[model samples]
Target: MPVYVRGPKDIPDTVAQASAAASRVLQSIIKGKIIKSIKDMSLEKIETKAKE
Candidate 1:
């Protein structure tokens, strides 16, 4: 994933730091997807999958 950090010149840009941020972001997105997938509102029967 393309990682970007918005900070002043004092902030260090490193591979490890970028990777860590990317990991956290990916995790958060997946968690949010799963949470949203489980919350379905429909009157008819429908097939669904979680966190596709």
Candidate 2:
């Protein structure tokens, strides 16, 4: 099933917190890949690189 999200003013505090957290996790996954793609194209290596 698909998920639906409502704003802070439209939902209770607990649901709003959960929705916000889910959004953050999705955003982080998308951003992490984009960052790795732009940096030396070294996404295939075993060792991890530090981000500054």
Best by TM-score: 2
- Candidate 2, residues 1-52, lDDT tens digits: the string is 9676954454587788898999987887787732535455565442453442
Off by over 4 Å in 1: 1-13, 33-52
C-alpha TM-score for every candidate: 0.37, 0.40
**Span of ten consecutive residues with least summed lDDT in model 2:** 43-52
Point out the worst 10-residue segment of candidate 1 by lDDT: 43-52
CA-lDDT, candidates in order: 0.58, 0.63
Best model per lDDT: 2
| Candidate 2 lDDT (Cα, 0 to 1) | 0.63
Q: Model 1, clash count?
A: 0
lDDT, model 1, position 38: 32
